[model samples]
Target: MSYEADVCIVGAGPGGALLGYLLAKKGLSVILLEQNAELGKAFRGEHLNEEGEAVLKSHNLFEAIEAHGLLRMEKLEYFNNGQLFKTIVADPTVGHLGIHVPQAHLLKVILDKTHQFPHFTCMLNTKVTQLATDESGRYVGVVASKDGISIEIASQLIIGADGRYSTIRKQSHIDMAKRKHGFDLLWAKIPAPKGWEPAIKMALIGDKQLSLFAQTNGFIQIGWNIEQGSFSELRKQAFTPFIQQLTKAFPDLTEIVVQHIQSWRDFVLLDVFSSHCDSWGTEGLVLLGDAVHTMTPTGAFGLNSALKDADCLASLLSKETIAQFDVQVFQQMREPDINEVLTKQIEKEQTFAANFLETAS
Candidate 1:
């Protein structure tokens, strides 16, 4: 099968979906391709900082997302030696310390909105195998297989939103400088404690950090930091002591943790990494979100930054035709802000111990 569009997006993540929606609404034909059969298959970090809130609100999408489900965090608390050391209340200027919304709900809502436009088409279970290039060696589109059927999707422009391990970026040979944060994460989710306030809780345990976030679905998401490449050795040791340390930080959750998290299999290991591509776009192809700048889940900047890219790019696309699109202009407009956020995330992770108390007024 052959399909042609004014804009071809290779991933249905936040950046691609949002950009597709904006372009289609402006009467431009857009084809959004998703390798997965549905949304929310991956462990998308469900966090929205103030910048994200502002972007959604600006687009008049925040109300719709909140109507689906949203949890506004009340405060951020730090614990030291099993005692509360500091508390940082939610700032009114910043809206809230954090907002949690399931990625499934957010993406579904955006896609549903896009469906209202006749120019938008979405393909699920479609995986891109290689970049489609012209004889001149310029990127023209992508070749993908859907349900074992090979299809050629040719477009004026191809947007790569396939995330950190992006096939499009890899196939295009866009080199990304990678960095490891010296630590990985163990994530688990269980029912929230009864009468628990919605907040982000952090504790220093064994020279590492344990973070608990209250979810909108009445669950508590726990992320424990461990030395990079040490999970295998650590798993061989007993789990009781580690579980007890978590209970010590929040004693009220002892019974809940005991009931839900029994074995090592209950936890999911997250390999932490940060990377930035040497360039974001070339000619007819461009990259966004984790594809161009993969972030550690430190400051919850990944999803929000993707939205910013989509929002900015959509603004540019809505005003100009594909022929007028300059990939350099898009890069120039977005790179500074992206770098700023990246630097902030790195600084936050590096000096967290030293500035732990300073964060609390």
Candidate 2:
């Protein structure tokens, strides 16, 4: 099978989907490919900050997403040794400290908006196997596989929004600098207790961070930081004593935690790392989101930064013809801000333990 478009986007996450929508809305033919048959297949970066909210609203898509469902965290509460010590409320003007937007809800609205444009095409369950280049080695399209069939897609420009371990970025031979932040995360979600308020509850356990984020559908997301590469050894230990620490920090969740997280198998372990590419583009291809700059989940900046990337790139693309497009300009415009966020994440992680200690004093 063969397809062609002005823009070819790999991945249907927030950044890729939004870029496709924005480009297609401007009347540029776009083809978006996703290896997954469905959106939100796994636990992903779902927290939306003010920057992300601004991008969604600017594009007039936030309301549609909100209609689908989202949760607004009203405040950030810090706890140490099972007692609340510091509380930071959202400014009245801002309305929320953070927003929990399920990726499914976000992608549906953007993809649905793109569907209104006749030039937009979405290929789910389609995986790009390799890049197609001309005599000059300029990327012209992608060779992908859908099910068992080979598919070829020709495009004027290709985008690598496939994420941190992006195939497009890999095939393009982009060099990425990776940094491990000395910790990994164990994530689990349990039913929110009756009348639970929407907020971010954080606890410190022996220099590690434990976070509870309230979700839209009466659920509480748990993120527990463990030593980097220590899950295997940690698992060898008894599970009961480990989980008891959670209840020790939040006694109110004792009953639910017992019911939901009885064994280690219930949690999904994430290898925490951040990465950056000095160059985000080469020839006819460009990378955005985690493909260009991957962030640790500390400040919930990854998703928002990706949204900003899509927005800025779309704006730039709108101003030029395909022949005149310059991916370097996009990198220049976005690099500084992204680098600042990456640095802030490191500082935040380093200072996390100090915050709890100061409160105790």
Best by TM-score: 2
- The reply for model 1, stretches above 4 Å from the true place, is 318-320, 355-361
Q: What is the lDDT, from 0 to 100, of the residue 190 in candidate 2? A: 98
What is the TM-score of each predicted model, taking all chains together?
A: 0.96, 0.98
Across residues 212-323, which tens digit of lDDT does each residue of candidate 1 receive? 9999979999999999999999899999986888999888888999999998899999999988977888878889999999988898899999999998888888536676
Per-residue lDDT for 185 in model 1? 94
Error of 1 at 76 (Å): 0.6
Instruction: Indicate the TM-score of model 1.
Output: 0.96
RMSD of 1: 2.2
Q: Rate the local accuracy (lDDT) of all candidates.
A: 0.88, 0.93
Clashes of each: 0, 0
| Residues forming the 10-long window of minimal summed lDDT in candidate 2 | 316-325
Error of 2 at 46 (Å): 0.9
Query: What does candidate 2's lDDT look like per residue over 129-235, in tens digits?
Result: 99999999999999999986999999989999999899999999999999999999999999999999999999988889999999999999999999999999999
